[model samples]
Target: MTSAALSVNIWSIPTTTAGTTRFTSKNGHTLDYRIHSGIVGNRWVKDQEAYIVRVGESIYKISWTEPTGTDVSLIVNLGDKLFHGTIFFPRWIMNNPEKTICFQNDHIPLMNSYRDAGPAYPTEVIDEFATITFIRDCGADNDEVINCPASELPADFPANL
Candidate 1:
């Protein structure tokens, strides 16, 4: 059987703000990212592959795969740079209807909310978020945002740098 052709979209998240960004496609579906918690992770997974991890009190299945005609030379060049670990992308055989999947590459920003109060002392805060690249299997018709705790990252998650 012939494999389905794939397409991709690339963009950047400018700041560590709390909001949602939406991308509309001609196929009548929308791709969106809702930044509820700015905490992000620096993990990398191969194209079309996924990994299950626990963040905080929640568990999420995160995956990533490269698309055709995309230039991954930068990522390849840094392959041997000694990362935390390697995450292999898995092959999938689907018998369902064909559709376009959206892939996003961005640093997931994380925030530190737990801080101690002191006399005339400012609360401890982390102004930065971890960079987490993601791939969405479904398009705009889905509105589910999987939530995971910021401290629940894998011990040896591959670095995307």
Candidate 2:
């Protein structure tokens, strides 16, 4: 599923910014406002933890930067069923996480995407690709370009994915 060959002109699209993401290591270390997160193989992982989180079963890093940045990195090993991701409960999400959501339309630029998370913000889910509907997972190999839409990705942008 990993392919660097882009299928779309991602630059034609604008860039959008999300909220601050929180990353916690296995040893109980917390880093807020992650600024960046990416996969090792498909994209360049600036955060060293990204490499560690991708491999080791004992460690997992869950990032929710969708408020401060455009990407949301989530690593989950269901077998461990560790108190991570959803229930990790960082400081910001403690009050009302539901209120957290990102927008993508004509004005704001939608740059990066993530691996897999929740649905994007939309009033009513549309079937057309006329608008830039951010992906549930967004990324790009180039550091300058936030989310590349991976080129081969469909324009529909995973309403049900």
Could you say which candidate leads in lDDT? Answer: 2
Q: Once superposed on the true structure, which residue ranges of model 2 sit more than 4 Å away at CA?
A: 1-52, 67-75, 86-161
Please write out the lDDT profile of model 2 over residues 6-118, one tens digit for every residue: 22212111122222222223222222112222211122122222222333533343443332133344443423433222222233332323322222222123212221232
Query: Please, what are the lDDT tens digits per residue for candidate 1 over residues 116-146?
Result: 1111122122232223233323432333332
Q: Which ranges in model 1 have alpha carbons more than 4 Å from their true place?
A: 1-31, 38-132, 145-161
TM-score per candidate: 0.19, 0.21
Candidate 2 accuracy as lDDT: 0.27
* Model 1 lDDT on a 0 to 1 scale: 0.22
- How high is the lDDT of residue 114 in model 2? 22
Model 1: per-residue Cα lDDT at residue 87: 25
Q: Candidate 2: lDDT of 128?
A: 13
